[model samples]
Target: MLYPNGWFAVCLSSSLKPGRLRTVAFMGNELLVYRTRSGRVRVIEPHCPHLGAHFGYGGKVDGENLVCPFHGLVFGPNGVCIGAGRSRTPPRAKLDEWLVQERAGAVLVWRHNKGKAPDWEVPDSNMAGFSAAQEACFELKGYSYYGPENTADATHFMQVHHLTDVAMSHEIRQHQMEVNLTASWFGWQIKVRMINYGVGCAYAESELPAWGLFMKSYSFGTPIAPLKWTYTLLDSTHVRWLDALPRVLRWPPQALVGALMHWLTVKEIRKDFRIWNHRRHVNDPKLMQGEMHIAAFRRWMMQFYLRD
Candidate 1:
C-alpha cells in the first residue's frame, strides 16, 4: 500500500527529551528522531551523509547540532555539516531533514511523495484544563483509511457499541472533514463530534450533558509497513465535580477519573480492532441506506493517496 501524503505521527512529544537522540520506525523505514539542547525536535534520515554512517548507532546532540560518530561531523539543526573531525574545512555533506511539528502532545512528520510542501497544518489540540493524555498504541493490519472511514460509519454504533437512534451529519472541505453523531445509549442521550485533519489524524469530542460527563480523544493512523500500521489514541476526561474541588485536592480525583475514562475508551475501541485488522475492502459493495458518507469518505481520501 502507498503511504498517504499527510502529517503522520512518529512518537509522542513527551517521549523525547532535550539533547537526546533516538531512532523511530515510520512508513516502513527507520528515521532518526532527536531533541536539541534548546528543545527543538528534528527528524532526518538516520544515515550520515559522509560514509553512510547510521546516526542512531552513536550520534549525540551538542546544543543545536547533531554530531556524527563516524567522522565527528557536526550537523546544524538544518542538517548541514559545519565541522568535520580533525579537519579545518568540512567536506561537502548534508543530511536530509524531514518536516516535523510538535502538537497535541505528539511529534508529527510531514510526508509528500511528490516532494510538495505541506499545504495544510495539523490543528493544535492541547487542552489547557483537561488532564494529561492517557495514550495506548496498537498494531493494525490495515490502511490508514480505516480510521476516517470508521468515523463516518453511523450504523456501526448501534451494532457495535450498542447505541440506538443514531444519526450522523458531515461537513467536508478540501483536506478537512467533520462528523457529528447523536444517539441514545440505553436511554441516555449522547452526542459526538469528530474532526479529521486529512485521513491520518482525527479529533473526537463526546458530550453527555445529562450525565455530566465529557471526553476528548485524538487518534493517529501511522503507516509502518505494507498492509501494516499503528493506531494510537490519546484520551482525556473532564468530570464536572472535579472542577468544583479545591485546586489542592483535585489532582487525585482528576487522575482517578481520567484513568477510568481511558480504560473504558480503550476497551470500547478494542472492539473495532478485530474488525479493522481482519476486514477486507469492498471496492463497490452495495452499501446499506444512510451509508452515503462512507462512499463520500472513500472519495475524500483519494486526494491524499494518489497514484504516481
Candidate 2:
C-alpha cells in the first residue's frame, strides 16, 4: 500500500527546537527533517549527493538551510542550493525537497509524485491540547491494516471482550445513508444521534484523525504496525491506548458477572495487544463475508488514500 505519489509521513514533533534534524521514513524513502534557527521546518532527502552521506546522523541546521557535516553543503527548505564549500558549484545539482508542513504540533512531509496534498489539515492546534498529557507507545506484530480494522469492527467488543452494550449494524443497502461524526477540539466527543439511531445509545468516539497522526508504520520493518489512540474517560482524566487486543478469552463467572466482565475486558484487550505482536495485515478481502463497516472503511481509505 506504499505509493510514492500516494503516501504521507509524520516527520517529527513540533517540540523539537531549531537546528535539530531527525530522520524518518515513509513510503519506502528516508526523510531528513530539520528545524531552522528560527523554528521553521524543512524536509529533504537524507543523502548528500556530493558524497552520499546521510545528513540525518550528523546534519546541522545553518540559518535557514541544512548543512551537511561532511562537505559543508547547505540546502534550503525547498531543497534549493544555497551554499557549498566549493567556490563555484553547478546550480543544476540541488537537494531534493519534499512537501512539508507543520500541523497539529507535528512536522509532516508529503512524498507523493508532487501531487496535491490531502484535504485534512495538519491539526496543529489539536496536538497542542495534549502536550501536557502522558505519552506511551506499543507495537503490534501484524499487517498494518489490522489496527484500522479493529477500530471499525464493533462485533468484536462482545466476542473478544465479553462486554455487550453497543450494537452496531450498517445499513448496507442504503449507500447514501448520511453518516455524521463530529469531534470536539480535543478529539473527544459524544456521538449525537441527529440523523440515525436513537439518543443515549450512540457511541463515544475518540482518536487521532487516521490520515495524520493515526497512520501507523513500523520503524523496524518487521511488519509490526503501531497505532496510537487516546480517550478522555468519565473522571476528566485522559487515557492513551497504545496496546493491541488479544485473540482468546476465558468466559465464565456468570454470577459475579459484572466484576468478571470488567476484569476480562481489560485482560482481553491486553491479550489482543499481545496477539497483535504476532499478526499483521489490516484489510481482509474476506470482509465481504459478514463485516459491514469494513466496506465503509475500504471506501473511506480509497477516498483519502487515492485523493488527488
C-alpha RMSD of each candidate structure in angstroms: 1.5, 12.2
Score candidate 1 by TM-score against the native: 0.96
Residues 150-236, candidate 2, lDDT per residue (tens digit)?
Answer: 545655544664444444444322211123233332333223111111100012223333311121111111111233221111101
Backbone collision tally, model 1: 0
The lDDT per prediction is: 0.87, 0.44
Candidate 1 per-residue lDDT, tens place, 1-308, comes to 47899999988888899987879778889889999998999999999988999988888999999999888999987778999889858888889999999877789999989999999998886576677789998888878778878889998888888899999999898999899999997899999999889878999999888867788888999988878888988888777767788877877777788899899888988999888898876778688978988878888888898865
Stretches of model 1 off by over 4 angstroms after superposition: none
- Could you say which candidate leads in lDDT? 1
Instruction: Score candidate 1 by lDDT.
Output: 0.87
Model 2 quality (TM-score): 0.60
